[model samples]
Target: MVHLIKTQSSSAKSRMGPASLNPDLPAVAGLGSFEKLNGFFNAIYDGPTEDPPWHSALNLLCETLHAKHVTLILKPPSPVSTGILVNTDAVAHDATEAYQNHFFTLDPFVGLPEGQVVTPEELVGDKVWKQSTLYREYLKPLDVKFLIGADIQTADGIECRFRVSRGGDIPFSADDIALCRLLLPHMRRALQLHSRLDGLETERQLFAGAVNSMQLGTISLAHNGAVIDLNPEARRILAEKDGIQISNNVLCTDNRREGHELQRLIKEALSGSAGKKGPGLVEALALTRPSGRSSLGILVKEIPPSPWTVNRQRAAAVIFIRDPEASVAETSQKIVQQLFGLTRIEAAMALSLANGSTIEETAENLGLKKNTARTYLRFIFNKTGVTRQTMLVRKLLGSVASLG
Candidate 1:
């Protein structure tokens, strides 16, 4: 049986926890009920970082509170800004849109302090709530009644509000308020974790896009040489399958000698032996295709362990492949000069690199000395805030400042 006992604290008078909802009803919420809640907490973290599985977790919360519908609403600090309101039920889109567009100001529970659990009657008495336009015109038509709200958090002018509502006359009981209070901390923590994970996913996408734009193929491998991730360029290279291909989810080249060397480096990198070789030690090899296309230059390097990757087993080493035969897109020299503040010669050098020309080759094609080309490259790098040719290429290709 659930009991409510009063106890005095050093700073306050005697306070009591919530009493049972109904003494007449049997206690359905036993140890097993709490076990289910624990499961919900664990399940919230086990999914794609971009799109979290919140709907299922909300369903579990609804079951615990015996609520008809649980809705999450976010209100920006400014009235003109658009915010989000999502409901556990699918049919409330029209009602929710109306609330966002018109009735949010009339909402009795808006602007509440964080962690304050409240009910409709507490905000406005039963008579006043019934007479309000929000209740009479908007909520009554939708058959929504009896709300319990708690402000989970407010950060950077964004307020996170969570509420549970019941319909058809009966109001939320003391038990419902207590249950909401109990689960509020876990819910708030979960939302914080979700925000952090989403930020990480965004950064990962930006880095991947920059790498792909440089026309470089990047592949991440696990300790066992299993493929973990491949950028867009890597996917294209693998699709050609002239020399490099995925065999049984592991990276493999057509030539036995080079494949064996590649596997050895991967293993050595994963085992942390790569650092013993020397500083900035990277293994390089060439993949020669039988069709006589340009050879693919592959470089394998160890990724140092970090606290951010303590739980991930497959983020140990990365492979970068440069294909000499692949066609390069021509970048506009005028756009390059405007974007990077480059002189005409420097812009020419940048565009030549964008078109897959080495410094010597570009110097020969432009009828300039190699030292002149090198000097121009340094100036371009300084203007673009990069210290290396690879970074310069990445910046030029990834930037949309010159694009139509």
Candidate 2:
């Protein structure tokens, strides 16, 4: 059994009161119940940045309601297998797996009419529940005598189940059921938040992977000029200490004049005034390297506020840096030479043109005559099946050739 365990809160056990009198009628929960619940809510809200330590919260729920054991299961219908989110250690792993594989079909709670919170006693009479195979054979072996569960979600044919079970013959009181009902909304919201955060994290990882693969340095900034996050490439540039580095969590360059200019651009972008000229305007600057190598190309672009922009604390502007002296260009050259079967000179010319250079500029850069450069460009156009220079550059850039 794959158990995702989280330890219980310290106060959870102490705050939970014993089983009350009049097990059939409702009773008011204690004053300390609200404080105990606040801890669970904190875990739920923290779920996006980190996995919430929900075991403590679930343990609190079981203890608060006087249930011996509890389990929460989130599963998609049919093709997708079920997963146990939380399970109290009181139940053996083997017993849980056995119930999951075989006894699940016999569960009276499986097809209970869709409702808020329902107990076995409410769904089926105590006599009828006792007579069922689920109790006589499966649950009897596990020693679970009573159960209370809620259907949290049943969207798109996927069902999420939250259930608490008690041992021995002592039945749950009305207060236990009411407590479960009270806790249902919090549990439901936490699950939804978990799902949303999972999606956002996956997208962030995918984007980060793509950016890293291309050797593009990306730095996300807060409104106050603090560094929110930096990709691997950005870190590499900062470590080089040739041109750019992060000081005081702010982007800095070796040259004081250049640094001042960069800071001004960053501030402008953060202020949401960088695009005042038009929409989606990207401010560009170049940082001179100490080694006198190719200057690093940097672009600071303002990002409009979105639903994901939490109070504009972070992600106000994004700085994209490109290091021309890096091995990325060499890798791209190799890829172009291999894929297009071009000579080294021809490959260099093709990449240069794709990077928005004119034929004259390509010739000058490669130390070749205008006619020789034109011949190479013509050959590239023929091989790539494009007549226009613009189309040829587009083809080369769009292909896997430029991904190096």
What lDDT does model 2 reach? 0.72
Q: List the residue pairs that clash in candidate 2.
A: none
The residue-by-residue lDDT of candidate 1 on 1-404, one tens digit each, is 12223333433221221222232222224213435545656644442232324676666667766677887764432378546665675436777777777788787766665787886667777788788888788767777777778887735333578878777777766655656666667767667776676688899988777667667889998877789989888999998998899989988789999889888888888888988999966668888997899889988888888766655665788989988877554456787888889998888888788767899999999899999888888888889999988898788767863241
Please give, for residues 293-376, the per-residue lDDT of candidate 2 as tens digits. Answer: 899999988877886656857588899998875654334677888888888888888878776688999899999999988998
What is the TM-score (0 to 1) of candidate 1? 0.74
The lDDT for every candidate, in the order shown, is 0.72, 0.72
Per-model TM against the reference: 0.74, 0.66
Give the number of the best model, judged by TM-score: 1
Candidate 2 stretches with Cα past 4 Å from truth are 1-53, 76-84, 88-109, 119-143, 154-158, 306-312, 325-383, 387-394, 399-404
Clashes of each: 0, 0
Worst 10 residues of 2 by lDDT: 19-28
RMSD of each: 7.7, 9.1
